[model samples]
Target: MMAVALVLSAVPLGAETLILGTTQVPRHFNGAIQSGIATMMPTAQIFASPLRYEDDWTPRPYLAQSWEVAEDQLSVTLHLTPDATFHDGMPITSADVAFSIRTIRDNHPFASMLAPVTSVSTPDPLTAIIHLAHPHPALLLAMSPALMPILPEHIYGGPDLADNPANLKPVGSGPFRFVEYRQGDHYRLERNPDFFLPDAPRLDGLIVKIFSDPMTMLLSLESGEIDMILLVSGVHDIQRLQAIPGMQVSDAGHEAIGPLNWIAFNMGKPPFDDVRVRQAIGFGIDKRYILDQMMAGLARDALGPIAPGSPFADAGIEPYTYDPVRAADLLDAAGYPVGADGLRFTARMDFIPGVPEQGRNVAEYMKSQLAPLGIALELRSAPDFPTWAQRIATHDFDITQDNVFNWGDPVIGVHRTYLSSNIREGVIWSNTQRYSDAEVDDLLARAATEPDPEERAALYARFQHIVVEEAPILFINELPLYTAARAEVTGLPQSIWGAISPYLTLDREP
Candidate 1:
């Protein structure tokens, strides 16, 4: 049975309860400070944003009732709802919106996202005008439910932003309130009766059950124990869940969070520092095979950082086709020759620890594929996600497998990983490869502020061509992420942000 402790006393009789399942563990409970599915999925419900998104990528009013862009495109004026109040009964005002925007810029991993914002001027308690240093075409996208969760300044104004007490015990103006969290088990949330939006959050409460084993979670879903499972990546299980009688599985929700899984090189290292070596490695591996066989034809081959689904993606860019002979020749030209021991060189390969489909299985496949190129591989194992993240952030591995996202726009997700200016130490997702190209940086900079869409796209195409040649990352298959839910679960989020949206209309059949 779904946990009813939170729903029983708080809601009226016959109110429905929502139960979700996930294997991923969050680093913390703040979406404004953290990225990725683990934290964003849950925190997005607990903390609301100025706007929510629809499946067509249309911006819908949420906490902020209406907003208008300045005629010069240098500022965005937000008119917040006067009735919106945090869970603690504190009125959410324009000041909180200003504070939240500034906080996200300073602490969030997407370094270039809010960097253009000069300041936020609060003309009134209901109006906040965001002043920008330049025209930011993707600024509104930065305020999406998942990307920007408005935090209460009065609660999170203390010294340590990351270590704030309110992160665990959050006080927000969202449809839900953080009730409790028991590690390695479940997270419970209660509906906020005083929510700003009327007739919102049809469900009385929510229970997110944490499972170490996804198979068990699937079985639970089959038995009607779990109402839904967010970001389900198990290939066979996805098919299995789809075939079940009373279950629904679809990847429609993740258009904004464009996920791609590929191999990342530490450019600070010797062998990977050479473009030929990286290119050789790319040529050695069969991307088509990974997409067709390993991924069960669920994913499409990714050529560059921009998602294939994005309007900005350049299909004209050259791709590294499977050619082992060419790969060996390049390796030979790079001064590595097969020794009497039958190996030309040795390298250590690591991967993100969770999800066997994307982790150990792919790493082992890479090891086997590279073995034919006279490369002896040592597959390094991480005990958990945090350990692997630390290794990547510190640039401790020679080569590793990684999964990244476009996050609705290139400015929010793509620029952070490729820009030299964002090569911040200890930041996991920001330029860990130490890649620095003035041309690439300049192209990205120009694209971020360019007013004309055509000019912006042209600049991105140029960036893609240069970066693909540099080969800091060997492009692989785009991840096909899905959300599995029981048929009874209605009003499932259909937005580009997917499971991370503020589900105000979530309901269940009696």
Candidate 2:
């Protein structure tokens, strides 16, 4: 059950190279810092000992040969494969695995996922034990995805590791190793000489060319400058690129089955503190119009916290249709009257400047829908991500547009966005709405540790029900899946879990 790389008849494997294009370049290589690590280090593997991950997010054997969960399920022990070695010729060890977990928990900027871990212990040279303060039913799922990237802690520790050039030149124990990085131009990687697997990566090296715009990137793909187009930001661009003659389109569909878009209301403010105003805002958004016009009908209109494909997604939570009379009636009842300009006295929305063109389309649609209800929607763009984040934390805007990314677990969306702990230290990424509900929190606590599938599903469904009724955030449409590869590339099957298509498995066009 392994894939071998093959080449076009005339091209030799060692001489073959593949070029990849993406519309946007990631800001950093640190996996925790951003969502782009899997793109950058396609060959890298996480160091979760015996628990290896397959493409479908099921656990298999990788650097870790195998693992066992104690009968109580309170702990898990892993055995590392002796064959595995880092690119620097260091043998993979249990200490490295322990250190990797600690590094992410102690120093990684995005530690929200792993903050629950109490301790990691290396009882022997080849085995590591993870003791949990509480049994996590989602542990297997978390270990399979974002929370499990393995690092060589021996290299990444101390101030030197913190400031090391190796952050960019990552010597991963994957199928490929970083070769060269030309700022704003291209980053290149070659086959890892230390790779443990046999009969491996067919291509000689992989080149990731960064194009500033989608049109340029698509053109590069057609001209053979780039072999594949990784991700397109909007539906219009996806359609245009698919029309290109030789290129093949693969639709992976909605990357995450959780809420992708949410229209956030600042509950710390006056009107939003009232559930009626929040519900009015929800009813005012013409989601169907936005999905049809802006997203080319490629978007799924959402009704609750979970998307349609999510296991916990319940259809019973009804969405409010755009009825101007109903929207205006709710606004009037909330004591917001039409002013001299025939606009409800509403405040402006703050959005990050230079946001994808889709944000502008959404804002324009909101303006049209709210205008009929006599609501004035002022759209203002902040300078950058940090600036926009700062404004959001300070509750400097009445409304904002945000796409909450989560991997189907309700806790990822529920706790981070509406829970009380997220409001700490002027840093509010998830909980921008400042929403809190005692009953919702109680349901969340129950859902977190409840192992019974039926029970947890019931608990989360209740939480989602409360969230929809309270309406702190306006649920928006989720995008349809799409991935493109030149006709020659092979080995990719459609995945249900939808972790960004594994880059290591992609081969040269045959």
Candidate 3:
């Protein structure tokens, strides 16, 4: 195993192919506008970002060779790799960088992510200067692989931004090139010979093998048919898989990709528009039960919107304790008395599609939990991710089970959920709750540009207190899993992006 230049060895191209098992089926290859692991897993390999975030939240160069922030902190200058080119062999320039930023500003679901950016100016072929209206502390972070993937202006600079045919056949300037996606079976990506980095992306190819069932996917890993499986959704099977020999199971490198499983409400509606009703329902769910019984010792209680271990998570917020009597009393106070048949009301519940791990199981558990307490729920299942996303985007459903990420910074991930300005129609993962408060709005706006860490944290602390009390979304236990990989796999991505990153150094030994 003689290394040539750190990431590269003299192994033959076909010697090392990484087969990844997943239950996730990606809707598209473009991650510029799309969020989450489904699209992100492929996008990070096919397309490269200006920078990638290390596990410690530090920024390192990816496509951009170097970057510098101005003294006033209102702008960032990116010096891209001179020889970087898309899969089609077109040189990557500042124009592409500029276009990508503009596209992201207008179309990205996190509408508030680039709210401070006024314009991007390209002075030279390799230099891009991003000018901000305010001091954006998360500018570099917003350019991370999952957050932003620099799209080639030549290929995608056409009529429709989000609805182009080129989306399916992506041409990117990363370490890998898109080969083919055979709908139900698998999506494959081959190594890019013309990659910017010298002797990088040690793998010959990467294949995402899709499974209709979690059991089948796990079986592939057990039989050595697949090299690894990520986002292992079946919580009950984690312990069983961890005991298998030649397999490594752990939840490391996911610190910044904070996923919280919880109930989100449609505040645009009647009973849910009432805060008392919302709080009553929040008081009904037992976060402890979800962790102890459901999560298989894989999760912690995510009491607030912010994930635990984050520097900004407030430990002092008064938790909504489990009190069915109080819930009943609150329902009575809110003018919804239990009927003669002992049912207060029923609302439709939808869960994100993929598998039962996300919202389906949680919705079923909540239905049982809330039924005895006089509230009835109608569980609605989305056949796929797109359908589930569409329902949330269109503001349909009384409440839904969802898994959302806090991608590194409060400005990048947390702001869009609470900011009133981000309540855009037909945008999944935006302010879909339809909640708006002038004070919460003010705090988020200030925190977005506030450079001082203590000041931004204080602002977020207040934001958490207000949202938790109002109960637009009830915090539940974190979505937990043990991603299993073969012991032969080395250089697995240790960044915050984890399994979804480019995995440039990933290699398998014979």
Best of the candidates, lDDT: 1
Which lDDT tens digits does candidate 1 get at residues 1-510?
A: 433334333433336878788887776788888877888887788888898887766788887899999888899999998878888999999999999999988888776789899999998999999999999989888888778888899999878998988777777778888888777777778888998888988889888878888888888888877788888777888889888987888777677788878789999998888899999998998878887888898777798988887778899989899899999999999988889989988999998876678767888988899998999879999999899999999999899899988988899889988989978788788799999999999999899998788999999999999999889998887887787889888888877777888887778878
By lDDT, the candidates rank as: 1, 3, 2
In model 3, the runs with Cα more than 4 Å from the true position are 1-13, 88-90, 160-166, 336-348, 378-396, 424-427
| Segments of candidate 1 deviating more than 4 angstroms | 2-14, 26-28, 160-164
Which parts of model 2 are misplaced by more than 4 Å?
1-13, 23-28, 32-57, 197-199, 253-259, 339-341, 412-414, 493-501
Clash count per candidate = 0, 6, 0
User: lDDT by residue for model 2 over 200-272, one digit each (tens)?
Assistant: 6556777666776667776767776667765455687678867878677775633333436667888888877
Q: Write the number of the candidate with greater lDDT, choosing between 1 and 2.
A: 1
The models' CA-based lDDT, in order, is 0.85, 0.66, 0.83
Which residue pairs in candidate 2 collide?
46-150, 47-150, 49-64, 253-481, 344-374, 488-509
